[model samples]
Target: MKHFIQQVLYALIASMLLLTACTKSTPIGSELIDQDQVELKFRDDFKIIAKSINVDSVKTYGPQENEQLNSYLCGRYEDPVFGKVEASIFTQLALEGAMLPDFITKEGTVILDSVILSLVYDSTKVYGDELALPQKISIHTMFEALDRADTYYSNQSFGYSPNPIGEKTFFPRVRDSL
Candidate 1:
């Protein structure tokens, strides 16, 4: 009986030790993490000056098939330093995947109410310091579709209506949220 009691006491002690040994693993480098430190060095050894460059001829390239543009720009600006700059863009609109619902289609003579064109501006993609100044902009309808087969360049011209569809004069205000 004494031997059995000793055996049972040993089994209990072994089980208690096994239970105590089992513990959750701690992640490495998790204890008391230090904040990141950054150091910057500045040197003013040489004087910087702007130089004027005269160009006899300048060449421009067009957009390729592999390249993709996010926005279509159409505007003309006259800068004292950069001279006159003009840009025009063409886009294709299609409702391929977006189909009208059956309920909307069932209703006869669906009259259009209003159309609104919203343009989101990217602050980081600015070129000149004319954002604060109010500029006149005119929008016209394209007469022809942009050819997918041909490459388009900055100097290339597209057919557009002579009359302006809309015109606005406002200062560009860059915002974080649209």
Candidate 2:
């Protein structure tokens, strides 16, 4: 019985070795992929004139109406080649259910302690030095309301308070969860 079991194991091992040894010299997915489609052609004789152009404006608002946004950037980064660049965020706050006025009327005088602003940070989207100095952020209330139907651009001006309601300076830990 012992000799029979040993022989069976040896046969199984030899079978596996034989199966693995029969490998084609061609690429693994060569059968599935077309040789013509995956061909690479290089051209270096032509002069390449690479010049960066300034973008005048970009549509930043309205995901449901005009534009869609996966994420919003609000920070300042100084690139050695591109100089200094800053991004600002202008967003409209919305209630979960009833209107603010209606809620106030029904629930009497509501004592609001604080307004918490939560943001999910994307590490991959961050450019420049991630370990640079702490970025200063100022939050101000907008005088004009943002309409969902209207499209807002990067260069478009929205009336906001001169004085900031809240201000915070902190180092951005991009990899860390909020």
Q: What RMSD does each model have against the real structure?
A: 16.0, 8.6
Best by TM-score: 2
Error of model 1, residue 19, in angstroms: 66
Cα lDDT tens digits for candidate 2, 121-141: 887788767566877778898
Candidate 1 lDDT, 1-178, residue by residue in tens: 9999999999999999999997977556545564344334799998876544554422223346346555556567676766776765555553445585444556565654545556677767766665557766666778887655556555556788889877877776656221
The local distance difference test score of model 1 is 0.63
lDDT of each: 0.63, 0.77
Candidate 2 lDDT at 165 equals 88
Model 1 earns a TM-score of 0.47
Please give each candidate's TM-score: 0.47, 0.59
